[model samples]
Target: MSAPDVVFVTGNANKLKEVKMILASESSKINLINEPLDLEEIQDVDLQSIALAKCKQASKLLGPGRPVFVEDTALCFDSFNGLPGAYIKWFVKSMGLAGIVQMLSGFENKGAEAITTLTYTDGEGHFHTFQGVTHGTIVTSRGPTDFGWDSIFQPDESHGQTYAEMDKAAKNAISHRGRAFAEFKAFIATEFK
Candidate 1:
């Protein structure tokens, strides 16, 4: 058997690097291509829909015969009733993480969750969507080892430490991306082979 042909379509450098690193294990049997697909990020919506839209856009750009993967993720806070669930990017830019932390201060509810929806589309326009979610809580302050919302978002009862408090490898090991990729790997292994 030969390696399957696929391309990863994303414009986020950080996310692209992360996904490529996670998928590197399949290099022996998969041709993983990374292409920056230009897609406008829509405002205030569930990430699943956003991910699907991104995959569709990439599929149109690539035409048919190859598979392209796209993912959109958001951090939802329980204290705010998921106010930032789909508006994370905008909030991150305008309010900054510190501002968000402050905004959630003095709340009895600091529970939070990271949700990721992976949209995988074959070249012919067929799509397979998978989701990965990690339940955690929001911390009063920041931690020293993670990025994005990791500094303040602690996994539920995570021994009083936020994701930022954990090492990169440790965090990635159980992250939303990790869960999603694991499922993607299994799916491809079973169905594509």
Candidate 2:
């Protein structure tokens, strides 16, 4: 038997890269294919709802009985009451990394949570949602500035290095995306097999 093909609906190259790395590490049998769709996401504070909506839309577009998945990531600050939960992308776009960190400068609490939600539709009207969260702090940007919010958020698990500073293996081991994919990979193992 060949590996099953699963459509991953995302446009962000960094996300795609990370997911691929995570999957490859465990020698996952699922074949992940990227379908970059400009699907409209529901504006909501709930990360699962946002990801589920996107996944459903992708399933419809791709036709019936086709397995597809969508991912939504959030960086929620403790002081902001998660002001930028599902809206982190927009905040990053409008404010940049420095501006986002500045928003927390006045507050004594620099605590934040990095979350990733992966919603999958088996195209059988059944949906599976997996979430992973990492407790961390928002600090001055360090390491490479290429990926989204990687340089600024330091995972508590890491000694002091940010996501960008860690190598691919190290980062994936502790990253929210990595944690989420761990659940996803297990699901694929049983469901797809």
Candidate 3:
């Protein structure tokens, strides 16, 4: 039997690389393909809803019978009551990493959660969602500042290291995306095979 092909709708190279790495670590048999689409994302505080919408749009564009998936990630701060749950992208864009740290400077509770919602569509309107969350705290930038919010957000499991500070393998081992993909890989094993 040949590996199943699944389309991953994303334009971000970092995301693609990380997903590929995670999947490869599991020795996934799925032939993941990157289909970058400029789908208009709906404005919603719910990560699943946003991801589902993107998956639906991608399915429509890819047409019938093609398996496709889309992902949406969020960084929700405990002190802010998840104010930036589904708007982390915009927040990072406007505030920058330093600004984000500054925004939390007044708050002693820097606790936050990094969330990843992976929505998959079978191109027939059937959608399934997998979510993974990693709890952490907001700190001063400590690593590579290239990726969004990676330098300031440190996972709870990490020994005081930011995502950008950890190696690819180390980061993927406990990342929100990794956890979400773990669920996704299981789904593919059962559903596709």
Task: Specify the highest-TM-score model's number.
Answer: 2
Tens-digit lDDT string for candidate 1 (124-152): 76789888788887665566523467777
Computed on alpha carbons, the lDDT of every model, listed in order, comes to 0.77, 0.91, 0.90
Instruction: Write the residue-wise lDDT of candidate 3 on 96-155 in tens digits.
Output: 988888998889899999999999987667899999999999999997988888899899
Give the winner by lDDT.
2
Off by over 4 Å in 1: 140-146
RMSD of 2: 1.1
Q: Sort all candidates by lDDT, best to worst.
A: 2, 3, 1
Could you tell me every candidate's TM-score relative to the true structure? 0.88, 0.97, 0.96
Q: Cα deviation in Å at residue 6, candidate 1?
A: 1.8
Better of 1 and 3 by TM-score: 3
Name the TM-score of candidate 3: 0.96
Question: lDDT for model 2, on a 0 to 1 scale?
Answer: 0.91
In lDDT terms, how accurate is model 1? 0.77
Q: Which residue pairs collide in model 3, if any?
A: none
Residue-level error in angstroms, candidate 1, position 125: 2.1
